[model samples]
Target: MTLHQLRIFWAVAHARSFTKASKVLGLAQPSLSQQISKLEDDVGTQLFNRNRNELELTDAGIFLSRKAELILSSVDETLVGLKEFAEGTRGVIAVGALSSIARILLPRAMHRLSAEFPEVEVDIHETAPAEALELLYGRRLTMAILATDSIASSSVSFHQTEVFSDPYVLAVPRGIDLAQVNDVEADLAEPDRAVVNSTIQFNFGSQHKRRIEAWYQKVLPHYRVIGQTRTYEVALSMVQEGLGVAVVPALTACVGADQSYDVTLYRTSLPDRRLVALTPSQYVRVEPFASCLRHLRETGDDIALPHIEPGPPLMKAL
Candidate 1:
C-alpha cells in the first residue's frame, strides 16, 4: 500500500527473488521479506506463490506490477521536477549510446553543451541498443541513443527523437573495385575475388540482422560468412585486414580517423539506420537533459560522412 512497499514488491517481481532484489537495492533480505509480507497481509491476497527456489507472480501480482511501474515512474518524475527548481541546468545526465556512433556525435555535442553550461556533466555508456534500452528501463541511464532497427519491440514507453540517419555501406578492402563488378565470381581476380565472396557478418539478434542477412543473400549469391562480430569496430577491422567484407553503416567506418580503418566503402541499397534518442517523457523538459539533447541534434545535423563509392548494378538491385 505504501510507496516504499510498492517499490520493494516491484523490484522483487522483476528480479524474481527477494535475495536478488536485495542485492540490487542494497537492502537486507530480511527487510525485503518483512516488507513484502506486510504488503501481502495488507492487500488480503497472496501476490506471489513461493515455489521452492523460484518465485512466481500470481494474477493479482501481475496486475499490480504494471500499475506499480506507472506509479513509481510518476513519482520519479515529480522528484525530478522539484529538484530542477534548485539545480537548474547543473546536474549529471547519464546517457547510453552505441560505441561507434558515440565517438562521432558525442564529442561535438558535449563540446557545445559544456561551452553553454559548464556545470552540466554527461556520463556516457558505450553499449549496444539492447543493453542501452535495459539501462534506460532500470533507471540507470537518463537517456539512450540507439538505432531503431537494432532495438527489439518493447512494451516500455519512451519519447524518441531522430538524431542521425546514415546509409548501410559495403566495407571492402582498399583498391578492390566493386563499382563495375556486378558478378563477384567473374569480375575480380582469384584469391582476391574470394575475399569479396567471404563476408564478415554482424552477429546479433534483431529485425536488422535478418534484413542484413537477406540483403547479403540477394546481392552476393555466392558469398559465405567467414567472420561474425557484434561490434562494428570488429567487423570493420576484419574487413580492413582483408579477412572479408562487411555491410555496415557509413558512420561505423568513419569513426575517429577514417584512414585508420584502411577499408573502402561502397553504397548499399539497404535502408538507412535511423538513430534516435530515447528518454522518459518527463526528462525531455528537464534541464541539462534538454540542452544535451539539443546539442546532440545539432551535431547530428552537422555531420559529414566520409567518401563512399557507388556499388555495381547488381549490388544496387534490391
Candidate 2:
C-alpha cells in the first residue's frame, strides 16, 4: 500500500533474502520482518515462501516484483523532472564504478557535475564492474563506468559509450635489460636469463590469468612468477626489488620520479584495455544520467587520472 513497503519488498525480492535486504536497507532484521508481515496482512496474501535453503517469492510476489521496478523507476523519473523544471537541474544521481576507475575518473567527473549543476548531488558507489552493472539494471544506479572487457555480462540491454583505451605495458625493474631489447626476436634470443627466471603476476580472473600466462610464454620463454598479487601497485613494488617483470594496465603502470613506482615500462603486443561508460537502456533519456556521462567523455583524461591537484576536488562524491 505504501511506497516504503513496496520499496522494501523490491529490495528483498532482488536480493532473495531478508537478511541481505536488511543490510542493504540499513534496517534491523526484526523490523524488516515486522514490516513485511504487516505488508502481507494489508495485501491479504502471502508474498513469499520462506524455506531453509532460500527465500522464494510466491506467484503474487513475482508479478509484483516486476511491476514494482517500473513503479519505482517512474517515480524517480517524475522527481527528476520536477527538480529539473524547478531548479534547472537534477536532485540526486547515484553512480557505481570499479575502485580503479573511481579513483581515476570520479574526481573530474564529479567536479564537472557540481560545477554545471550546483544543486545536483552525485552519490558514488565503489564496486566491481559486474556488481556495478547489476546495480544499474536494478534501478539503484543511474550509470556506471567500467572497462569494456571487464564486463561479465552475456545478455543485458544497455547503452554504452567507449570512453578511452589504455595500453598494457610490461613493467620491469629499472636494472632489467629488456628496456633496450625492443626487438622481440632479439629479446627472445638473448633475454636477461635472470629476468625470465622471476616474474610477477596480477590476475583478476581465470581468463586474464591465461592471457598473462600466454603473453609471458611468448616473450619471456621459461619465465617463473616469483610473486603474485591482485593489484598492479603491489606487483610493481615487487618489480622494484628485481623480482620479475609485471604486465599491467597502463593507467596503473605510469611511471614518474614522484610516483614511487620505480619500474621501467615497455610497450607490449597485448591488446589494449578499453573502458566504457554505460547506463541501462531505460535511463538513457534521463537528463541527469546523460549530463553526468557528458562530464566523463569531455574530461575523461582529467577524470581518469590517478591523482588530482591540491585541494577539495579529491573529496569523495556526496
Candidate 3:
C-alpha cells in the first residue's frame, strides 16, 4: 500500500528471505514481516508462500513485484529530476564503480564536478560489475562505471556510454627488464625466466579469463599459474613482491598524479579494456547524472598512463 511497503516487498522478493532483506535494508526482520503482512492485508491476498524454509512468490506476488519495480524506478527518477530543478543540483548521486577506476579517476572527476556545481555530492560504492548491476537495478545506485567486458552480454540492457579504453599491459618485477630481452625463453636468466613463466591469473569474467588463458598459453607455452586473484591491485602488489607476473590494465598500477609503482609495465598484443558508464536510459536525459557522465569521460581523457615499454617479439606475437 505504501512506498515503504513496496520497497520492503521488492527487497524480500529479490533476496528471497526476510532476514537477508533486513540486512540489505538496514531494518529488523520483524519490521519487514510486519510491513509485508500489512501489504498482503491491504491487497486482500497472500503474496508469498513458504516452502520449507525458502520463500516462494505466489502468482499475486509475482505480478506485484513486476509492477513495484516499474513504480519504484519511476518514483526515484522523478525525485531526482524534481530535486535538481528545485534545489539547483544540491543532492547526492549514488555511483558504483570498480575500486581501481574509482581510486584513479573519480577524485579528479569529482573535483571538476564540485567546481561546476559546488552544492552537489557524490556517494561512491566500490564494487565489481555484477554487484554494481545489482545495486543499479535495486535503485540503490544511480549509475555504474566499469569495463564493458566485465559483465555478461545478456546482463547489459541499460543505456551505456563509452568512457575510455585502457590498454592491457603485463606487469613484472622491477628486477626483470623486458626492454633488453627479445626472447623470453632464450634471453632471460633462469630465475628471471621462471618469474616470467609463472603467471598470476585473474578469475573473473568468463570471456576475459578465457582470453587471458589463451594469451598465456601462446606467449609462454610452458607457463604455470602460481597464483590467482580477483582484484587488480592485489595482483599488481603480488608482482611488486616478486611472487609472479600479471597482465592488467595500465591504470590499475597507477597511483595519483606523480605516484609510481615498483613493478615494470610492458605493452602486449592484448586488446584494450573499454570502460563505460551504465545507467537507465531515462537517467541519460536527467540532470546531474548527465553531467556526471561527462565529467567521467573528461577525467579519463586527461589521465597520463604509466610508462609501458614494448614487450619482446616472442611475447607480443600471437
Candidate 4:
C-alpha cells in the first residue's frame, strides 16, 4: 500500500477515532475514511472494531501500527542524516534524557553543543528513565542520560559515564527546633510538633515508607517518621510549608537565592545514587557527540558529587 495509506491507518489506530485522526492529519473526514478503507482492502482484513463511541484496534492493526511507527521514524532519521551529510560538517544527534536531567543538565549541554558544533542539530526528548531506554533501543535516541538504578536492556550497552551523584540529605522546616533532637528520635519525639502533624497529612508510598522505617529502626531507633513521598520536590514543598522533615537527594534539594522557602540541608548517612549517561556502542565513536559527553563528565556540577571520570575512551569502529 502507499505510504499515505499507512500514515492514515497509523494515525487512526493511535487516535482511535476517525474524526479525531482526520483533524490531526488535516484531511477531510471522507478522504481519511477512503484511505483507511483502501488500506484495509489491500491488507485483506479489518483493522479496527467500532464500539458505540470508541474504536479498538484489531490484532492485525496492532501489529501493523508498530511496524508503521518504525518505518516513519526511519524515514525521518534518514532525511536528517542526508541533510547533515550535505552540509559537510557536524551531524544531527537525537538525545533523550529523564525529567531530572532535562531540568538540570540539558540546558547547559544544549548551549555548549550549539557554541561548539553549530552545524550539528541537536534534538532533545524529555521522558521517564524507562521510556528513554526504550527509545534508545529503537534507535530513536542516539544517547540518553538516566538514573543508574534503571536496568539497561541487552540491545543497549552501558557506557557508565557518571553524570551526577548525590547523597540523601535530611531537609527540615525552617523554624523547627532541632537542638533537643540528637537524631531522628528527637525529631520524631514531638509527634504533636507542627512538623509531625504536617507529615501525617501527606501520603507516603512503600519505598519512602521503608526508608523512614529503616531510619527509625537502624539509624535512630527512637525517632518516629510521620510521613514520606516519592517526589523530591513535593517533600521540599512540604518542608517549606512547616511540614515534617524529608529525606531527599542533595542534588534535587539544592537551595539558592531563587528559593523563597526556609529549609536546611543536613548531611545524612544514607547511600547515594548515581546518574549515568548511556549511549549506543555504535554512536560512542562519533566524535562530536562523544566530545559533548566528555565535557559533561568533566564539568557538569548539577549534582553534588565529585566530577565523574571518563570511562574507557570510545574506540572508533566506523
lDDT of 1 by residue, 88-167 (tens): 54578888997887788888899999997888878999987766765665567889988887655552477888888999
- Kindly indicate the candidate among 3 and 4 with the higher lDDT: 3
Candidate 3 deviant stretches above 4 angstroms? 9-23, 28-66, 153-157, 179-183, 205-207
Judged by whole-model lDDT over C-alpha atoms, candidate 1 comes out at: 0.83
lDDT scores in order: 0.83, 0.69, 0.84, 0.61
RMSD of 3: 3.3
Residue lDDT tens for model 2, 1-318: 898888888877766677877766777889988888999999999999999877889999988877887787678667666666784544677878765567666666778878767877878898766566656645577777877777665314457877667777777677655434433344534345566457888767677889888877766566777788866777877888777778877677544323436667666666888878777555567666677777777766543322311211111111
By summed lDDT, the worst window of 10 consecutive residues in model 4 runs over 309-318
TM-score of 1: 0.85
TM-score of each: 0.85, 0.69, 0.83, 0.58
* Error of model 2, residue 52, in angstroms: 6.7
Please identify which of the two predictions, 1 or 3, would achieve the higher TM-score against the true structure: 1
If both were scored by TM-score, which would come out higher, candidate 2 or candidate 4?
Answer: 2
Q: After best superposition, candidate 4 residue 19: deviation in angstroms?
A: 22
Candidate 3: the clashing residue pairs are: none
- Tens-digit lDDT track for model 4 on 1-318? 887787777667756677767765668989988888888899999988978786898999889977976676566545544654665665767778754466666666767767777777778887656556656544557778876655444423445567677776566676554434434433445543545334421133345457645653553333444555545666678777775666666655544323323566666666676777887554454557677787667546643431222211110110
